[model samples]
Target chain A: MAKMHVKMTVNGKAVEALAEPRTLLIHFLREELNLTGPHIGCDTSHCGACTVDLDGKSVKSCTLFVGQANGAEITTIEGIANADGSLHVLQEMFREHHGLQCGFCTPGMIVRARRLLAENPDPTEAEVRFGISGNLCRCTGYQNIVKAILAAAATLNAEKEAAQ
Target chain B: MIPAPFEYHRPASLAEATGLLAELGEDAHVLAGGHSLIPMMKLRLAAPEHLIDLQDIAELKGIARTDGEGGGEIVIGAMTTQHELIASDELARAVPLIREAALQIADPQVRYLGTIGGNVANGDPGNDMPGLMQCLDAAFELDGPNGRRRVAAREFYRSAYVTAREDGEILSRIRIPLPAPGHGFAYEKLKRKIGDYATAAAAVLLTVSGGRCGSASVALTNLADTPVFAADAGAALAGSDLGAAAVDAAVAAALAAIDPAADNRGPVAFKQHVAGVMLRRAIARATERATERAAEQTV
Candidate 1:
């Protein structure tokens, strides 16, 4: 098999890499782009640790091939911060709320939660639980993870209203 | 684990895709979302020499309700993702069961990447859409070297990992006739947890008129080699008030039709019981909704 030249916008940065058609998007992000925030918890799609925002929707990076994602815009955990390198609201909430213990699934959780809030800015407790059901957090027992997401949604919504 | 080496081809049109498939022959496999296929490739269960990516084919996208000779029909592109199906209000209004079932498939992330075409075409017994499509009486449109054709969803599956879709043909679109207005629908699935395949699932679409069942369709998932249509079970509820007797007969018919081989879920008898329970729940909810719809129309 021949390596294909793949180009895409990752975290608002243009990146071009040569990868085999069999190379997964998770490996491409970790190895080529050096975006290690998206951890590969389970190679299979069961664990959502490799979740990334692809074209505005959350997708498991481990299950997608690099060649198939060519020419698409992608956002991993690293892209969720502010332009001046400040923690995004979701990250801040995670720290304030103690959303993680071992921190292995933190990046994926924060990344997916940001998208969830973006899609449903005012999610209820049950809705928040269901929205992030795909992303697992074994450490916090999901109590604080859910709290952090809800807190982030409130803060983000408040900021939006204040800006107006 | 990484997948084995394979050449990737992105065809821009259906003709190009079919040409690639016909040219590559047995060594080629169509890639639609790749949620299932990629994992299989990683496990070395499927090692195709050529992988035809269908993402670039513009024609294999979108959802629209078009008028046909028989009535209204919802035509969904094969590459439409599960998320797309859930988000399409046209489809939701025409056939709400599609949304009900799509929400139960995998999870939000998987739903974003998983395509309905791949779900129905892959012949995975655990997939939710095939059984629901049978209940909706949807037709799959295929494009191959021999040109275009349609196959009824009820008759599409031959066995697990086998279907009526020909080797060189690509499922281009799924056409579902709009259910009669005031139709009731529900998809009841009993899985161990979220994102898990159903222990047993049932889809029901029914229309009630004058306190009696006018028509009904029931389909079961992961209870057999293929999605079971449960024709006898559906017949049992037709022209009845959806009474206790009618519901019991339908459940019995559904239990008899299903041939579930228990692996981790439960024993054969346990799965059969679960399947019957799912059918009864689906039928009850569907009938209730149908009766409500019938009452609303009279006003």
Candidate 2:
């Protein structure tokens, strides 16, 4: 099999590279572009550690080929910060609430949580749990993780209201 | 666990896809969502020489309502993702059962990429959509080198990872006849967790008239090599008041149709027990919803 030319927008930057058709998107991101924010925990689709926002949807990068993602726009944990270099509300909430212990699943959890919040701005505790159900966390036991998401939702909503 | 090297082709049209499939022959596999196939490729369970990706094809996306002989039918393009199915308010209003069942598959991230076509066409016994489609009496439209054809969902699956879809045929869309107004539906799945496949799941659809079942359909998932359309189970409920005895009979009939084998989920006896329980719960919920719909119509 020959290598394919793949082009995509990642983290607000256009990237072009030559990759094998069999290369997983996670590998393409981490190895080719050096964007290592998306971790590969299970290397399978079960663990959401390799999750990234592709064309506005949270997707498992491990299960997608670089060729399949051609021309798509993607976002990883590295792109979730504010333009001023401050932490995004979700990241701030996670840190304030101690959403992680080992920090292995934090990137995936926050990436997934960002999409979940964008889809539903105001989510309940149960909804937050269900929203991030795809991303597994063994260290924090998910209590603080859920709390962080809810708190982020409240903070974001308050900001919107204040702006209005 | 990287997949073996393979040539990749992205065709922009359905005709080109089928043409590539015919040209590539048995060594080629059509890529849909890649949720199921990619994992297999990574584990070396499957290694196709050519991967024809259908993502660029415009014909295999969207949801629409078309007129049929009896009533309107919902025609869903094969590329329509599970997340799209759950988000479609029109589908929810027309055939809410699809939305209900799609919500239970995998998770948000997987649903974002997992297409309805892949779920039904893959012929994986563990998939929820095949059984749900059978209960809905859906038809899958396949586009192949020989042109287009439709296969009933109930008659599609021959065995696990095998279906009526011939080689070089791409499942283009799913057609579901709209259920009667005021019908009740429920998909009761018993899985270990959110992303796990169902150990035993039941899809039930029924309509109530004058406190009795007017028509009913029941299907079971992950209990055998293929999704089981429990015709006998459905037949046992028609015209009944849906009493405890009638429900019990229906459950027994459904259990009789399944040949569950021992695996990671459980033993044969446990799977059978759970299948019966899932069917009973599904029937009760469907009955309740049907009665409610009937009441709403009367009001």
Candidate 3:
């Protein structure tokens, strides 16, 4: 198979690369772009470690090919930080709440949590658990992970009210 | 696990896609969402020499009602994502069971990229849509060298990973006839955890009038080689109030139709029991909703 020229916006930057049709998006991001924030816990779609926001929706990057992501705007954990280099609200909550233990699933969990908050800014504990159900954290036992997401949601909502 | 190398084609039109499929021959596969296909490719279960992606075709997108009059059928483009289905207000109003079943498919991420066409057209017994489509009596619209054709959802599945779809034909749209006004519907699934395939699931749609069932349809998922339409089970509820005796008869008929294989979920006997349980739950919910609708109409 010939290499296909793929161009897309990644982490708010334009990126163009030549990739084979079979190259998974996770590999393309981690290898070609060196955006290793997204981990590959399971090459299969079962593990949400490769989760990323693509065109306003969270999708498993490992299951999609680069050719399929062509022309779409994508965001990984690297893009989750503040533009001024401060930690994102979700990241801060994760840190404060000890949402992670080994940190292998943190990136994907945080990324997915960010989207969950975006979609439902004020979620209950059960809703938060259901929202991040795709992203697993074996180390944290999910107790603090759910707490972190709920805390971030409340903080974000407060910030929005203050700004208004 | 990396997939084998294959030529990729993103056709701009349905004609081009079918032409590519015809020219590429039997070794080609249509790529839509690729939640199922890509995984199979990586596992080496499917190694198509040519991959024709249907994402670029404009005609294979969007959800709209057919132009026919009198509660026109809801036609969803095959490429519409499962997330889209869950969010569609039209689908919720026309066929709320779709939203119910789609929400139970996988978690948020997989739902974002998985397409309804891929789920139903592939004839994966584990997929939720095929059985729900059967319950709704939906039709799949196919486009190919022979032009357009529609196949009833119940008749489309031949076996696991096999369907009535021809090699050159592409499932372009899914047409669901509008359920009668105030009809009740539900999809009950029993799974080990979130994002897991159903151990056994049931979809039921029915209309109740004056505390009796006017009509009913029942279908089961992951309990057979193909999604099973329990016609006899559905018939058992018609003209009855869905009392304990009628519900038991329906559950028995549904359990009889299921041919579950022992897998990680459970043994055959356990699956059979679970299938009956799912059916009874689905029937009860449908009956309750129908009764509510009937009460509201009187008000």
Q: lDDT winner among the candidates? A: 2
Candidate 1 on A1-164: residue-level lDDT in tens?
78999999999989998999999999999998899999999889887899999889888899999988899999998898899999999999999999999998898888888888888999999998888889887777899999999999999999999999
Better of 2 and 3 by TM-score: 2
Number of clashes recorded per candidate: 0, 0, 0
| lDDT assessment of candidate 2 | 0.94
DockQ of candidate model 2: 0.92
Residue-level lDDT for B288 in candidate 1: 85
Candidate 2: which stretches are off by over 4 Å?
Answer: none
Question: Each model's TM-score?
Answer: 0.99, 0.99, 0.98
Residue-level lDDT of model 2, residues B229-255, one tens digit each, is 999999999989999999999998998
Model 1 Cα displacement at B6 (Å)? 0.3
Error of 2 at A97 (Å): 0.4
Clashing residue pairs in candidate 3 are none
Error of 1 at B264 (Å): 0.3
Candidate 3 per-residue C-alpha lDDT over B1-299 given as tens digits, one digit per residue, 9 for 90 to 100: 99999888899999999999889899999999898999999999999988998988989888896646776789899999998998899889878999999989889899988999999988899999999999999999999889999999999999998899988999999999889989998999999999999999999999998888999999999999999999999999999888999999999889888899999999999999999888888988998898898888889
Model 1: how far residue B169 lies from native, Å: 0.7
Pairs of colliding residues, candidate 2: none
User: In candidate 1, which residue pairs get closer than 3 Å at backbone N, Cα or C atoms, i.e. clash?
Assistant: none
